[model samples]
Target: MNPPDVAAAVVVGGLFAAGCYLLLQRTLMRLLFGFLLLGHATNLLLLIAAGSPGAPPIIGAARIGDEPSADPLPQAMALTAIVITFALTIFLLSLVYRSRQLHGNDEVRDDAEDRRLAENQQREASAAAADPHRTNGSGQARTAADEGGNTL
Candidate 1:
């Protein structure tokens, strides 16, 4: 392939990789940046998929039987995507701002119930370690206290 096409492909790959990495972060700001990168990558891919640039679709721009006219559909779709991405970006930014204001940080918080469950598991583990004969919620012994839940 040509140098330009190769460069574009590399850029698209880099954007996808960076976007995915940022998307996995805990902060809303990074997530926003990730989404933007992903959106741009998508737009570029759409343009590339639409084929090489050609003359504008205007009448008389290209001879009737000569050079081909550009396809308007991909251009329209890309434009629509850009607008939607902009609107969503604004909405997400406002959400992130409000989250920071309310929580004093932009990091995504863990669910309260999940935290409580993890704590409960930790406590249960410590308790079982302390008492070898203790049984858990499922009526199974923490140690080798019984076999098949029955004693001979």
Candidate 2:
């Protein structure tokens, strides 16, 4: 590959890695930025995959197989990706604004049910630790299901 192609590849890789890292963050703004980076990376990747740009594919502009013609599909796909990304940006911005207005923050919150389940598990662990006979005859740790045979 040429120097420019190598640079583009490195940049695309960097953008994708950064995008994934930002997406893992627990904030709406970061998530939005991550998506933007990913979109850009995708466009770059498509452009690179389309190969070096050449003469326009105009009808009768050139003899067949005389000169390499630019691929139209990659450009079209990139344009479509841009439009979709723009729509997603608008939607995310509106969502962030709504979240700020309602909750005063864009931080993603965990579900209440998940917190409750964690608390229950902690309580069960503590109770088992405090009980001398909590273990079964085989010295295996007993679970909530074993005690009451109840499935929540």
Candidate 3:
């Protein structure tokens, strides 16, 4: 391969790496940007691999005995890729918008407090199910007073 082709490959590879890194981020915008970068990197790699341009790939009486024309397969493939990427970009953008609207935030984060609360609730529910109406000696539901008034 030529120097230009090698450079293109390197750049495309770098873009792909960056895209992959960005895609792992929690933010939806970063994910969308990563996807867009990945699409461009793929298109660039395809273009570089197709070789330099020459004559059009058209068969006519004027060139019946000429050398092989430029291959349009890569170009066609790139076009299809671009169209698909565009559609995906639109879909992803819409998804990001909907997520932002519903969550009121774009960055994804774990709701630790919510998870803890849910776990506690589940524990309490299971305890209640196991002992429906088992009251302590003081006729109260296991309070600090029953445990010698040691505030937690």
Best candidate per lDDT, number? Answer: 2
lDDT of 3 by residue, 1-152 (tens): 43566678889999999999999999999999999999999998888778876577876635645555777899899999999999999998998999899999888766666655555556556667778776442234334233432422
> Per-residue lDDT tens digits of candidate 2, residues 54-120?
7886777755676778898899899999999999899999999999899999999876667556655
Off by over 4 Å in 3: 1-4, 61-68, 109-152
Model 1 Cα lDDT, one tens digit per residue, 28-67: 9999999999999998877776776667888756466666
Backbone clash pairs for candidate 1 read none
Best by TM-score: 1
Better model by lDDT, 2 or 3? 2
Clashing pairs in model 3, backbone N/Cα/C closer than 3 A: none
Candidate 2 regions exceeding 4 Å error are: 1-4, 60-67, 121-152
- Residue pairs of candidate 2 with colliding backbone atoms: none
TM-score of each: 0.74, 0.71, 0.64
Q: What is the lDDT of residue 35 in candidate 2?
A: 93
Query: What's the true lDDT of residue 57 in model 3?
Result: 83
What C-alpha lDDT values do all the predictions have? Answer: 0.79, 0.82, 0.78
